[model samples]
Target: MKILITGGTGLIGRRLTLLLQKKGHQVVYLSRKKENIKDVIVYKWDISAGYIEPEALENIDYIVHLAGAGIADKRWTEERKQEIIDSRIQPIVLLKKYLQEKNNSIKGFISASGISCYGTDTGEARLDEHSLFGDDFLAYCCKLWEEETRNFTPARRTASIRTGVVLSREGGALPKMMLPVKWGVGSSFGDGRQWMSWIHIDDICQLYLQCIEDENITGPFNAVAPAPIRNAAFVATAAKVLKRPFWAPAVPAFVLKLLLGEMSAVLLGGNYIINKRMAEELSFNYQYPELETALQDLLK
Candidate 1:
């Protein structure tokens, strides 16, 4: 199979590309810059101008859309929020237009969504794919992201993965969480009872692969592990795995709010999301279902 990936240089995209290549599938990248990328044939795409290199779509069997700006990369000013949505929606609009115009045999389209679709805070309620979407800015962003995928015509199969907090040593939240712990000043945010749905880096990559390979799998699927941990337990476990002292008081909510503004909701609030479709419908096996096992693999 020949696959084309957007945001192919990102954390998840980079690992997924290697996995597909190791399995003997041809991988190509649709990047903003065609230069400086080695070992892969990169095709340039400019989302702002609604342009995609015509040859990039040639002979491509599958496409994984992971091309979105980092949601937490900046303060959620009105302008930054618009960029977050545009970064995700514009790519789909461009690709959908091209897919409609081009005569290609693209079998599947898999795109990235976030668990934040459920909301910043669900307290202890367990959420599945069919649950009501949250009424916050984050949920609004994910809703728009997933809605655009429905119009990807001509693709036989389309799946939108609502991914959880990916625990990776190389990037994402794990390293930042590990940083303060390594300094013995690690602490949970808020009161520390917020439920965090998390997945190991490898498990998430395999989930994406499953969506790509399994024609029976379509629609929205949660990419979280079966077990969800509280924020306090998550930090304590990380400290234990790193052999560091966990003795700091929880960070006060007011301080976080003052520091991060609207972005503070992500750290101070969380939801309990379930991988019901992945576990029951697909019978997927996770490499790291438990937080301790996941941390051990990444930290120790």
Candidate 2:
């Protein structure tokens, strides 16, 4: 199988590319970087203007849409919010148009959606693929991202993975969370009862592979671990794994709001998302279903 990936240089995309290559599948990257990679083909594009290199979409059997400006990279000013949306939407629109114009045949389209689809704070209710969209900036972003992905016509087989917080040592939230713990200043955010749905980096990559190979899997699937954990427990476990003190008082909600502005909502609370479709419908077993095992593998 030949795959075309947008944002192929990003944290998740980089790992996904390597995984596909190891499986003996051909991977082509749709990127602005002109430098040649050893086994991968690089195609250039100007995302803002909605232009892509002609050859990027050629001979592509699958499309993995992961290009987007980091949602937490900047304070959620109105401008930053728009960039986040456009960065995701424009790339898909460009690819869709090209595919339609050339009448190319694509077997499957797998996209990266967020668990934030269920909202910033979901309490104890385990949200699923059929759950209603959360009313917030992140929810709005994921909605639009998946909307474009689902609209890729001529390719009916599409999988929009609503992912949880990815625990990766190389990038994502794990390192940042471990930073303060390493300094003995780590503590939970606010009351620390907020539920956090998470998945290991390896598990997430394997899930994406499952989506590709399983033609029966389609639509929005909650790509989270089997068990959901609270923020306090999450911090406590990280400290234990790193062999650090978990004695700091919980950080006040007001402090987070003041520090991160609208983005503080992500830290102040989160939802408990379930990967029901992955388990029941697809019968895909998770590589790391528990937090301790996943954290130990990454942190220890």
Candidate 3:
């Protein structure tokens, strides 16, 4: 299989590329800069200019669309919000047009969607694929992001992975959480009871590979661990793994609001997301099914 990936330099993309390559799949990465890597092809394209070198589309069998502006990069000002939307929507529009023009023989189009579409803050409800869309900015962004990919239509089999907080040792939430915990300042956010749905990075990559091979898996599937833990529990688990005390009082919501602005809702929010479909249909074997175990392995 010849797979082309956008945002291939990102945490998940970088790891996914290596795994796919190890499995003997030909991977091509779309980038803004040119760099050489073994057993992989890199193509340069300026997505904002609406130009994707024609040759880049040649013999491409699968497309994993992970290009987007980081939601938490800066305060969610109106301008910053638009940047988040454009970074995701523009690439999809370009890819759709490119596929239509080339009449490409692509088998599948796998897009990266977020569980945030379920809502900014979750209640006691365990969000599944059928949950109502949230009215928040993150929800709106994800809705439009997924909708843009739908334009691929009848020609290509499409699957959208509504991913949760991916737990990895290299970067992301784990490291930030670990830093404070290492200093024994680890604490939970808000009331410390909000549910957090997460998955191991390895599980996420495996699911993406499964989507490539499984023809029946289509539409939005939650890519999260089966177990959903409270924010407080997650903090305690991290503390335990680092052998630090988890006795700090929870951070007040007002402090988070002042610090993160609109983005604070992400910290205050909780969702019990379940991978019901993935388990029933795909039978994914998780490498890190428990939170404590995941934290221990990642920290070590």
Considering every candidate listed, which one attains the maximal TM-score?
Answer: 1
Note the residue pairs that clash in candidate 1: none
Q: Which residue pairs clash within candidate 3?
A: none
State the weakest 10-residue window (summed lDDT) of model 1: 32-41
Position 270, candidate 1: lDDT: 90
Tell me model 2's lDDT, rounded to 2 decimals. Answer: 0.87
Using lDDT as the measure, the top candidate is 1
Compared with the true structure, model 2 gives a TM-score of 0.97
Q: Estimate candidate 3's alpha-carbon lDDT, on a 0 to 1 scale.
A: 0.88
Candidate 1's C-alpha runs over 4 A off are none
What order do candidates take by lDDT, descending? 1, 3, 2
lDDT by residue (tens digit), candidate 3, 1-300: 899999998888988998899898989989888889777789988987899877888888889998888888799899999999999889888888887776665888899999999887878987788888899888998899888776676236888899899999888788887788899988999998999999999989999999987878788899999999999999998988888999989999999999999899988998899898898888889999998888878888
Candidate 2 lDDT over residue span 1-300, tens digit each: 998888888888888888999999999988876868889989998876778888888888898888888878999999999998888888888888888889886999999989997788878887888889988888889999888888888576888988889988889898999899999888999999999899988888898888887777789988889998999999999898888999999999999999999899989878988788888888877778999999999987
TM-score of 1: 0.98
Q: How accurate locally is residue 288 in candidate 2, as Cα lDDT from 0 to 100?
A: 88
- The candidate with the higher lDDT, 1 or 2, is 1
Per the 3 Å backbone cut-off, how many clashing residue pairs does candidate 3 have? 0
Cα lDDT tens digits, model 1, 234-283, are 99999988889999999999999999999999999898999989988999
